[model samples]
Target: MRATLMYSAGDVRVENVPDPVIKHPTDALVRITASCVCGSDLWPYASMKPEDGPARMGHEFIGIVEDTGSEVTTVKRGDLVVAPFAISDNTCEFCREGLHTSCAHAQANFWDGEAEEGGQAEAVRVPLADGTLVKLPVAPDSALIPSLLTLSDVFGTGYHAAVAGGVNERTRVTVIGDGAVGLLGVLSAKRLGAEQIILMGRHQARTDLGREFGATEVVSARGDEGIAQVRELTGGHGTHVVLECVGNMPAYQQATGIVRPGGVISRVGVPQYEEAPIGFGSLFRHNIRLAGGPAPVRAYIEELMPDILNGTIEPGKVFDTTTNLDGVPAGYQDMADRKSLKVLVKN
Candidate 1:
């Protein structure tokens, strides 16, 4: 089997690796059909990541179940399924409460070790199979492949951010960033009935997709200028809700600055640092609600799947490029350099 491995900063390689085998009674082995490089993957690929050994990269995928552990029963061999990036046992207390991303067992599974194998490979071993895998209605059309694959992460995550930010019939939402997740955030806001959608972007192509996804306005500003424009658009009140899709420090502050006093700022970006300063003073004074983190993808997938199937949400539009497993490095470069919105990898 071949997999994407991260050796160090700016060092990503496609190399042969051992095939995965089920190691837990609740685990299943999947033959990845389609996988994509996530914005999160770039964090480690473009900077220092701590690990004693080579780490399998990627975590967003749609695949066929090759085999399942003894306890697995919801899915059988040959079923096509979408696996959420976070592994969870749906029956746990947290999972039952719709907080699968914070499931005790799932979070505990990561705290003791170097983390599990990633999805950017030919095949992967997925734990919590019954809870994590959501079987699609049928083998999707080739045209639907990219969209279906997005349910594993970005689309689902973007939807979570919109929901957390409280998009509704009268809300004006601003999405910061033009990446895959940000583009999907625009779609999410539209679907949830936001009255106005503004996407802050620098690229024409990405802004165009923001329109396709229902952005009513596009601001071609960066840093303070962008934040000021977003504020101006909202009649000096700023946005009712703001979606922060970029994980870095600058984007994080911009997200906070561009929302109304009582607005909600939802961050889907994975912050690169262990300690990030939240502007608690402004938050406390303005009564703004700050929310978001790794999207609870498992809890939201069931509701979101129907929208994707019916074409109500065209999240696939975010996949501006597609390539094979061997072209993993180019996939990273294109995204890192903003040449592509997102890349879909075929196994």
Candidate 2:
């Protein structure tokens, strides 16, 4: 089988690799049908050094069950399933409480934790099979596959940002970034009934899609200017919630600057920095709340799939490009170079 690996900065390869087999009682072998490149993958694409060569790539995937371990019962061979980016035993205390990302099971982990397996390949070995893979009623060739695939990460992540920020009918929202997650965050906020949605991004194509998703306005400025634009839209009060989807220092600062004194800043973007302002002047004094982390998408998959099935929202539109395993290396480059919002891989 062929799989994607990042050899170093700007170097991604799809090379032949050994096939995966069920290795644990709770494991299942899935033959991947669809997968995609995530914006977070760009962090490593730009800075990964030679020493980190050959890291297995990809996490979000929808596949057909080829085999299952003796203990796996929720799915069977031929079942179409979507695997969340993180591996978890859904019965764990944290998982039961809707925090599947913090599953306490001894074998729980992210796709990268298993060095040999990656979703951007012919197949994958999914751990905690029963808890990690959700069966989809749609067929493998369903038109909804791309939309259904988003349930694995981006869509669920955007939904988490809205839910954690406590978006409601009366809340005003500012979604930072125009990548897949940010665009979907706009969709999620609209779904949650936010009346006013402001999307902060310079990309006209993506922001247009954001408008289709539910953004009432688009702010392309940065720093103080961008902050001023958002404030002006909300009567100089800023929005009730800030969905920081860029995961960069500037995006974080922008969230702080445009969030109302009593509002919340939800960060679904994976933070690139360790130290940030949480002191009186930044968050404490204003009584602003901070929320969001690795979205336990496994917990939200079931709750969010119905809308996709009903065609109420088209989050998969974020995937502006498509390729197969052979083109994944170039797909990574396209995304890193901002030539693609997201790339879908079909195998």
Candidate 3:
């Protein structure tokens, strides 16, 4: 079998590797049908840091179950499943409280474990299969493949952030990025009944998609100017909810600068590191709520899956390009260089 390997930061290659087998009683070996690159993957792919040799590169996928352990009862060998990026047992205390991402048995393989079984490869050995993989009610059509694949990450994640931020019918929300996750944040806000969706971005294609997703206003602001523009649009009061999609210092400040005193700032961006400083005093003075983290995608997948299946939400629109598993390195490059919004790999 051929799989993607990351020798080090800024180095990714396609190499022939041994296939994965079920190693745990709760594990399932999945034959990946489709997988996609994530913005988070670009962090290690373009940086200078130590990474696992031959580490798998992707996490969002929709695949057919090739085999499952005797304990796996939610799905069978032939079922098509959307596997979330994080593995969880779904029965843990945190999982029961809708925090599956923090489940006691949750596991994420992008940085460790079997490097050959990440979502970017031809196949993956899914841990906690019964809880980590969501079985679709029917076999998805080819055209719906991208949307189904998104259920594994971006779509559900974005929805979780928006909901956590309390974007309601009367809320005027400001979204702080233009990535696929950011675009989906706009959609999630709209679906949650936000009346005025303000999307901050400069890319025409991404901005256009933001509008389609439900952005009532588009702000092409980059730095201080962008923050001022957001204030002006809200009568100097700022928005009611701010969605921080970029996991960088600049975007973090932008999110804090443009929300009302009592507003909620929900951040879903996967931070590369946790060394940055946040103004706790300012947050307390303004009575703002700062809430966000890796999305508990499983908690929302069941509810969001039906919408994706019915064509009510087009999360697949985020997948701007596709490539074979062998071109995984190029996919990372394109996404990092802003050459593509998202790319899918056919496994």
Candidate 4:
């Protein structure tokens, strides 16, 4: 088997690795059919120190069940399934409350102390199979593969931001960032009936897709200028809600700056900073609320599956580049260089 490994920043390679096998009663061995590079994966690919040895890369994947441990019963051989980025025992208290990302036994599939668990490979060992894997009603058509794959992470994450921001029929929303997640955030807001959607992005191609995804306005400005653009569009009152999908300090600042006094800022971008100011003067003075974290993708998969299966939403359009397992490194480079919105790897 071959898998992707990051030896250091700007160095991603697909090399032969050991195949996976069921190691726990709750585990399942899946033969990956499709996988992709995530923006979060780029964080490490860009700045990881040389001393940090190669680490397995990738989390979003869809596949066919090859084998299952004795305790796995929800899925069987030949069933097509998707694995959320985080593996969780869905029976835990947090999972029961619809927060699978915080499950008591939660573990990132890509960091299971072994390289064989990565999604960007020939196969992976999925722990908590009964709880972490969502079985498709039937084997998906090739055209539906990318869309189903997004449900494993980005789409669910975007949906999380929208739900947390309280987007509704009367709400006016602004989504920061036009990455795959940001574009999906626009889509989620539209599906939830947001009255207005403003997307803050500089790329013409992505901003165009943002419009197709339901962004009523695209603000190409940055820094204070961007803030002014959003405010001007909102009648100087700022938006009723803000979705922060970039996870950078500047993007966070923009989110807090353009939200109305009583509005909420829902963030789902993988935070790159260690600390941020959220004191009284920054948030309490305006009565603004902040919410969001790693999306409980497993919790939302079932809810979003129908729309994806029926073709009502095409979040898969985010995958602007496609490649084979061997081309993953180039795929990463294309995304890191802003030449592509997202990359999908067909194994």
Candidate 5:
């Protein structure tokens, strides 16, 4: 089997690796049909120290079950399924409460020291198979694969942000960032019935997609100027909710500054900073509520699958580039350089 490994910053390689075998009763072995590079993958690609050694990469995939452990009854061999980025035991209290990301026995695919299960590979070992894997009604067509794959991570993540931000028919929402997750945030806001969706993004291509995804307005300005534009659009009141999809200090500041008093800032971006200003003068003075974390993708998969299957949503538009497993490094570079929105790897 061949898999992607990050030796250090700017160094991603697809190399031969050991094939996966089920190691737990709750596990399933999947032959990956499709996978992709995530925006979060770029964080390590840019800053990982040279001495850190290589690490497995990728966490979004849709595949066919090759085999399953004794305890995995929900799916069988030849079943098509989507694996969420995080592995979780659906029986846990948190999972029962719809917070699978915080499940007591949860573990992230690649980040949990499991090299055999990284999505950017020929196959993967999915633990908690009955809970973590969602079976598609039928094997998807090549055209539907990318959309189904997004349910494993990006789309679910953006949906989580919108849900946390309390997007509803009466709310005015502003989404920050225009990456795959951010653009999906626009779609999620629309699905959740937000009255107005304001997207803050600089890229013309992405903002254009944001509009297609239901962004009522696009603000290309940055820093204070961006804040002014959003404020002006909202009649000096700011928006009722802010979805922060870019995990950066400046984006966080923009989110905090443009949300109206009593509004919520739901952030799904992997935070790059150790601390942020959430004190009385920053978020408290305005009575703003901060929410969000790694998305409970498994929890939302079943809920969102119907929309994807029924064509009510088309979040896969984010995947602008497609490549084979060997082309993953270039896919990573394309996304890191902002030359592509997202890359789909067809194995």
Candidate 6:
């Protein structure tokens, strides 16, 4: 088997690695059919040190179950399924409450390479098999594979941002980014019935998609200028919700600047900064609440899959490039260089 490994910043390799096998009664082995690079993966790809060299890459994927452990009952060998980015037992108290990312099970985890496997490979060992794998009605050759694969992470993540920010029919939203998650945030906000959607992004191509996804306005400016544009568009009132999908200090500051009092700033992008304003002038004085974390996408698969199936939305449009396992290294470079929105890897 061959898998992707980040040997250091800007250095990715697809090298031969050991194949996976079921190691626990709650585990299953999945042969990856489709997977892709995530925006968050770029964080490490930008600055990972030599000491942190060679970590397994990829968390989102759709695959066929090659085998399952004795305790796995929800799926069987040869079942086509989607694995959420996080591994969890859906029966846990947290999962029941729609927070599968916080699953208390010993084996539950995000795909951070602690398990010695990844979705960007020939196959992977899935822990919490019964609880983590969701059966897909589509076949291997379905045209909906790209859309279905988004359920594993990006679309669900965008939905989490909208849901957590309490977006509703009357709320106005400002999504701070035009990446896949941010563009999908526009879609999610539109689906949730937001009154207006303002997408902040510099890229013309991505912002164009944001409009199709439901952005009523696009602001390509940054810093105070960007804030002024959003305010002007909203009659100086800013917006009721700010979906901060760019996980940077500047993006956070923009969110704080553009959110109306009593609004929420939802952050789904993995933060690159450790320190941010949380004082009265930043959030407390305005009564603004900050929300969003790793999306518990496991809970959203069923809720989100139907729209993709019915063609109500096409979140898969985020994937502008496709490649095979061999093209993964170049695919990462394309995304890092802003030449691709997202890259889909097919086996």
Off by over 4 Å in 1: 49-53, 106-116, 273-281
**Residue 18 CA error for candidate 5 (Å)?**
0.9
Expressed as tens digits, the lDDT of each residue in 124-221 for candidate 1 is 88888888888988673467878888888899889989988889988999999888899999999999999889999889998999999999999998
Q: Would you estimate the TM-scores of all the predictions?
A: 0.94, 0.99, 0.95, 0.97, 0.97, 0.99
Each model's lDDT: 0.84, 0.95, 0.85, 0.89, 0.90, 0.94
Candidate 2 Cα deviation (angstroms), residue 164: 0.6
The total number of steric clashes, by the backbone 3 Å criterion, in model 6 comes to 0
In the range 46-129, model 6's lDDT, one tens digit per residue, is 999989778999999999999999999999999999999999999989999999999998888999845498899999999999
The candidate with the higher lDDT, 2 or 6, is 2
Which pairs of residues collide in candidate 1? none
TM-score of 1: 0.94
| Model 6: worst 10 consecutive residues (lDDT sum) | 106-115
Candidate 6 runs further than 4 Å off: 113-115
lDDT of 3 by residue, 87-111 (tens): 8888989889998877886353322
TM-score of 2: 0.99
Clashing pairs in 5: none
Clashing residue pairs, backbone N/CA/C < 3 A, model 3: none
Clashing pairs in 4: none
Going through the candidates in order, what is the number of backbone clashes in each? 0, 0, 0, 0, 0, 0
**For candidate 5, lDDT tens digit of each residue in 1-347?**
99999999999999998889888888899999999999999998999887885888889988899999998999999999998888887878988999988788745333335655589999988988988888888664556788899998999999999998899999999999999999999999999999799999999999999999999999999889999999999999899999999999999999988999999999999998989999997799989999999999888888898898888888999999999999999999999999999999998
